[model samples]
Target chain A: MARLTLDALRTILVACAGEDDGVDLSGDILDTTFEDLGYDSLALMESAARIEREFGIALDDDDVNEALTPRLLLDLVNGSEVRAA
Target chain B: MSTQSSTAAGASGRRVVVTGLGVTAPGGIGTEHYWKALLTGENGISELSRFDASRYPSRLAGQIDDFEASDHLPGRLLPQTDVSTRYALVAADWALADAGVGPDAGFEDYDLGVVTSTAQGGFDFTHREFHKLWSQGPEYVSVYESFAWFYAVNTGQISIRNTMRGPSAALVGEQAGGLDAIGHACRTVRRGTRLVLTGGVDSALDPWGYASQLAGGLVSTVADPERAYLPFDAEASGHVPGEGGAVLIVEDADSARERGVERIYGEIAGYAATFDPAPGSGRPPALGRAAELALAQAGLTPADVSVVFADGAGAPDLDRAEAEAIGRLFGPHGVPVTAPKALTGRLCAGGGPTDLVAALLALRDQVIPATGRTARVPDAYRLDLVTGQPREAALSTALVLARGRHGFNSAIVLTTHRP
Candidate 1:
């Protein structure tokens, strides 16, 4: 599997929010909390699950709780994939 | 009729009254919408749109084409539950609002409880998981699948979400469990619980749900919409499948009075349950005995019952059996009978609670709703089956009868709240 890209993670978060189909989120989505984007726990969970499935990585319970924003989640996903490789 | 046997249990126990009603039925969304649709005698059954049933024997169902779960539920709840659970949650929202309560209505400190019944829970969710297991692998399956299909999920979720800490349970009597749930609620209230939420919700519209139902061979295979599910009619072949639920706020009458609840629908004056004869036992079904016991517990005679909500099982023998049961209790053609289920097909366990909601509405409005789409009653039934339009009457008392597909029989007696 290819490494997780910032653009790809942005697309997943935007889709999980149901804000738009393919809006460009290459800016500061990494710093914005899910609640700041009007995304609920359900949306965040969906994003986490999709990230795991798409990147072929497992997120532990603590990692999921710690990854409250896009940047944190991307780091976790990258770390898991590195460990797997 | 022995008065002692009839009034003994009722006189000693705390009286239970229906304070609020909520529904997500095929015909409409809320209680008012449902009642109006029933009054117009409209048929809600249509060709199944959930999937292609063209090759299946039963092609029609009481499908809710316009249910948008997001409209009634929060996003957090959507990921963990199925459509049936969504229906129960939505219905609970309506029932609580109708009863003038809120999520934080101060009942958290009181002994409020919830009791729900369903033969099968969330088959639609289960079907999706099975497809995943077969196509992708078990590893791709979801953990939510465990509680979503469990029959008790409704009660568990309702109690948890609403902060109800009293006695809560789920009953599994298939069709009859809907009415039985209310009976159980009443018993819970009589045992000192202040209030209880009771009802049932089920949907067999998907492949797994429909396949299990098809195996029973009891669904209507009629191609024409009008001819399908003609309960109590000579041409009655079988029932059409349906998906929906109803929830009622069953409360101690005194507690409701103290809470200033002005709109009491009716009191659960009596209820009874009985088993059908073992196959080939040469004895008639025990539905009539159940009816007799319910009426007796209500301290009422057949003459006191203003209307009879027929089960309308939609098979010839089953219809005749229910008719005979009514006949034995009320004498031949003794009471005005109607089966509003012809309007929305059989909702499995949901049907009985839906019928109870209709009966309560009838008592409140003083009009007996018609049995939609059923034109003629077979002579063998000897019932004054209401049809065509809503019948205006003094519907002060009603008996709702239900028999599970699995042979559980139950009857509940409701009377206008006198005190």
Candidate 2:
């Protein structure tokens, strides 16, 4: 299976909830928290829903909430097995 | 005999005036465009293009074809809000800019407030979420649905965006809710708030929203745009559903003058709302009572009003009731009456504020826009209905009326600021 790359995560984040004008997502943003990145909890939830649909993964709500950074979210997505429909 | 005034009379000493207006209606996006459309007697009702409305019986709507939300709002707000709320946010921005009250405008966050109305909330947003819940499971639904579909979402979003921490509220009287919102904001200003962003904006043209409107049984089924909605006419059947409305900067007159605001639209001189008696109660509709009380609150007689912006529900019984109320107050064909909604259809909660905007502009320009294409007026109705062409008159004061489905009736009187 292909891994979820940082570029793919950036695309999902911008597509789900727009990017903040002040925040630069192009640089090293893997360790930065979503709160500092200007994306609120609701925005993260929306991004998670979109990522789940695209990656064919079912993420636990609490687990998604705990994954607050891009690095963590990428690891979580790449580690999960594609659920059978 | 003097009319009995409601609690609205307590704020009689503190005058409230409209300083700025922002509109996103069917025919136009801004106040200038809207006014020009009204003057030219342009109609905005057309076949619904939001979705595949072919399956519905009543497919025509007063849709805003040119409003590209991306042009007016930021991308972050795009995902958070629905179409109706987007309209309101843009309208509020325009109104605040028009009033010259921005971040640097000296007014504190606590002095500015927002009081808006919406009948169905964000139907488009809610419908999409519901589809996900049924098809892709509950986890797929967006978290914004928690408040996005709420009727008070407009007020909340407007207040939050502008950081308006002053007295604010949200009303839901269906069509009458728009005027009710303005009236409440006037009261808030009288209590010493500096300014209030008031009025309403609503859009529910999606399949679910359209179905809800059809369930009301008040929508006209005629496919022709011109003949679909005719108010005060013998052939009046029902109204065509439409979307969008107006938002106004209602400020304390003294505060507005202190701020050096030059263009004052008009003073919100009087306002009153009343509930109708139960059906089959052998009692009359309270629309006339509401009008009389509003005029009395303004210390004006029926003759003082130069023109009337009527509700014009465009249904037989509703039209007759509104006409009778006008006749009782202004006598038979005593004052010029117009319902520009004939062009835009009934905009639900947005309808009343839109009419109020028309009244204020008419008072400013001394012209009454025609009731677009509603020509076959029944003589028995006794309304001096303005049709075909805009009527130029020496207008000073204008009376606006609105009635909701479940027995809500509201009346507001706007007079020239200098007068």
Q: DockQ, per-model, please?
A: 0.15, 0.59
Alpha carbon lDDT at A13, candidate 1: 59
Cand. 2 Cα-lDDT = 0.90
For model 2, residues A1-85, the per-residue Cα lDDT tens digits are: 6678999899988888887777899999999998998888889889988888887888888888899899998989999999998
Index of the highest-lDDT prediction: 2
Per-residue lDDT over B332-370 for candidate 2, one digit per residue giving the tens place of the 0 to 100 score: 999999999898888888999999999999998899999
Interface RMSD of 2: 1.6
Top candidate, metric DockQ: 2
Strongest candidate by TM-score? 2
Q: Report how closely model 1 matches the true complex, as a DockQ value.
A: 0.15
List interface RMSDs for the candidates, in order: 5.9, 1.6
lDDT (0 to 1) per candidate: 0.84, 0.90
- Candidate 2 CAPRI grade: medium
Structural similarity to truth (TM-score) of each candidate: 0.89, 0.95
TM-score of chain A of 2: 0.95
